[model samples]
Target: MAWYATPGGLSSLSAPQLAAARRSYDLWSSGNPGLASKYSFDSYVEYAQQRHAESVAETAEQEED
Candidate 1:
């Protein structure tokens, strides 16, 4: 029911979901030694937003059937 913007597009991630993404990204980056060299935090956030959008769309499509 809520929306936010990322470089990828508009996203439906709520504040809590976005917070979760941040935490997840932080954890993932800390755990992966090569992470910091490859991607910036902003890029990771964008990726999470895009992934969340795809997940929402896929779930909606499945439910419509």
Candidate 2:
């Protein structure tokens, strides 16, 4: 699956947010101008939240060991 967002919209994101998005979605790393743009800020937030939760869970599991 691919994720897409407008260049204008992507441009509005903070550097950290853009970095995170690129990290999350490998396809975005290619520097493609605009192809099948589908994501919005909300979607990015959700993705970030999920990653946070997973990280928290991993930490908790590690602590239990």
The number of the candidate with the highest lDDT is 1
Pairs of residues at least 3 apart in sequence or in different chains that clash in candidate 1? none
Residues 26-62, candidate 2: write the lDDT tens digits: 5542454253156544555456556666777899999
Residue 51's C-alpha lDDT in candidate 1? 74
Colliding residue pairs in candidate 2: 4-37, 4-38
- Please list the C-alpha lDDT of all candidates, in the order they appear: 0.66, 0.54
Off by over 4 Å in 1: 1-22
Instruction: Write the residue-wise lDDT of candidate 1 on 3-65 in tens digits.
Output: 223434225456776676667667988898597569876677777667777887899999999
lDDT of 1 at 35: 75
Q: Superposing every Cα of model 2 onto the true structure, what RMSD results?
A: 8.9
Question: Residue 17 of model 1: what lDDT?
Answer: 60
Q: How close is candidate 1 to the true structure, as a TM-score?
A: 0.61
